[model samples]
Target: MSMIFSWRRRRAGRGRAGKDEFPDMELSIPTHFRCPISLDLMKDPVTMCTGITYDRGSIEKWINAGNNTCPVTNQVLRSFDQIPNHAIRKMIQDWCVENKSYGIERIPTPRIPITPCDVSEICSRIEAAAQRQDAKKCLDLLKKMKNLAKESERNKRCIVQNGAGCALAACFELFASFSIEEYTDFLKEILSALTWTFPLGDKGKSKLGSAISLRCIALFLKGDDLSSRKHAVLVLKELISEDQDFVNSLMEIEGIVEALFQIVKVPICPTATKASLVVLYRMTLSENSEMITLKFVDMGLIPCILEILVDGDKSICEKALGILDSISSRDQGREGMYENALTMPLLIKKILRVSDMATRFVVSILWKLCMGENENAVVEAMQLGAFEKLLVVLQVGCGERTKSKVTELLKLMNLYKDELDCFASSARFKFLKRPN
Candidate 1:
């Protein structure tokens, strides 16, 4: 008769005699779990053929649950499917297999195994090869560096997960080893490789792809070749247009707007909207006004922009306002696209009607905008019956210094100048007159 060993007893890996031969031996429950079908702890857990249990049901219940192991061999089983479909369980299991703690997860990649080589030493050799202009030697050293990068990436998967530091270091070494004319293709190839650019750890996975892509992009930009810079811009733009999750982070890239007009369509994500606007602002800031008016204003982006002004996120609201102010400041052929954007009367109307503090802040931003160019915003401020509110804020009894600033502003609106004396007579500067 086959001995019926309890799951715990099997995990204990004891002999049939149950005598403690190796008393202190510690056994690990395999990170790869077993199948319940064959009544065995899983050796190689496949989904259907050999179920790797995902959810480790209570061990006592799993063992007692009894229908465990490879049903094919009536023999007591060692392989069983890990059950349940919890994403965290597999993550934990993968972490264990990598010998990594949850706090530090590694992004995995396939690496060429080479003996432990000091990257710094390798970098020195690569640089020397490049200096000698020995193309063959340089190529050889580059291959070795690539191998080192691969190995480093593999090792980092369990440790750093995103391997951003390792990837950058490796890219830098490769960069040092090649002349621009000889290495442009090589850099392009590496950046294009889908396998090489991901982040290292589980936590880093979401941001890793963009981060690494940006690094490659930065390197490309530094190359003397304008064509290469253009190509790099294309790649980054493609990534932004496609990857919704990465939109916000991608917006943070420096000098990104250098390629803004190349994008024909807008990304659907709000972050992308904000990013695109930022790029637009930077590009047009110093350019001729026709570019701003013909490109952005004529394209009818103002409405979409106004919608962003109403957004609840404070930073986004502020950024939008700032961009609008930038537009207002541009020469723009001395044309009115800037006012076309602010549409002051419409905005002031919303400000008076909208109740959210954020909206009020947004209105305040519009007020500031009008205060500047001294025309479009002022006309709209006068038309919207904003004078009373402006006067009230300017007068005492509202809030803090903001009120004082508004009062000063009302003094400047000229439309209120004649009426100011009439208003001042009724309300005492008495609030200011009140004892401190």
Candidate 2:
């Protein structure tokens, strides 16, 4: 049997060659060695329960895309477990060695996949160290987990699935009370790891929402380590999103709002900036939001948001506009918008330019500022082409609420048309006639 097998292998090696298989040497690649999914020679072959072998990377990608059946056999995958086809791998490697002269390189041995058991062991060690108050060991383990998460999305899913998130949250809660000067490294590592293990279950979110956790995160926000500060903002955004009650505790933390505003003012990254904006928006949703809005107005949030409006991308602009609209609900917020010189021009420029949602926000802000006793805002907006922009918004399409505001703004403009020097003679005035 061995002789026959060797003879057949040699005969297969000399079989008919395909033009595309080995362009330079015209070598024949056995069809059995190619993966059914990719039609390429399988490197790191894995066998699914359906007895179909595919390249590990290809099959894993298929499953990650939410496929539950084997690609070739169309059989339901009873289990996700993929067994290594060592014999096929060995055969492929030997074939590559035989074809070394044709430029085929040998595939390196694949590393052992990270399993739930491996993650559980790591979490166990982290929990034990936290119990013993072993800051050094905990930091080392956290660094390991961070590195692992960086390796692949698979490792990250495994780590989070195996209770790594809860373990890290517990460590953060325990270590956060210590002196920042002493446990700064350990605490930073925990924050970094927690950022990777996001979409945390309710338990993890609850632990992270504790007052102690809020306080620690606030300190990190003010810390000089830009990475830690960004991570803290991201984690804070997650916590506030999961539990609205935590916003009350967050508001109580000294300097938290100011820190978030500073990040918005001088963004560390786009992600951090958006997260800060979201946290600020959530603060405006709390019961004491009137007070919060007043606080934001005092802290120069209006000008900061206007700056973002000037250059922010679509999504960030939407968030900034949401916060601004929230702030505009308060008397102080409207006053702040009126006081800033660039506010009118920026808001006018954004009227029909950004998006429908953004247009709605700008219209609401303009309505809040102009509908009141402030005539200069109306005059300023008219001078800055607000009349024509509203015309364009009408000519195009807008939300019903936005269309109503535009109509009211136009009537308000008409009330001042005779008073304003530029309104009567302008050709655009005809377009402002009231829509029946």
- Identify the leading candidate in terms of TM-score: 2
List the lowest-lDDT window of 10 residues for candidate 1: 1-10
User: Per-residue lDDT for 35 in model 1?
Assistant: 38
Query: Given candidate 1, what's the lDDT at residue 100?
Result: 38
| Residue 21's lDDT in candidate 1 | 33
lDDT to native, each model = 0.46, 0.86
Provide the RMSD of all predictions against the true structure, rounded to 1 decimal: 18.1, 7.8
lDDT of 2 by residue, 239-298 (tens): 778788989999998889999999999989999999999999999989999999999998
Would you give me the overall lDDT of model 2? 0.86
Worst 10-residue lDDT window, candidate 2: 1-10
* Clash count in backbone of candidate 1: 43
Candidate 1 TM-score to native: 0.37
Candidate 2 residue-pair clash tally: 0
| Candidate 1, residue 196: how far the Cα is off, in Å | 13
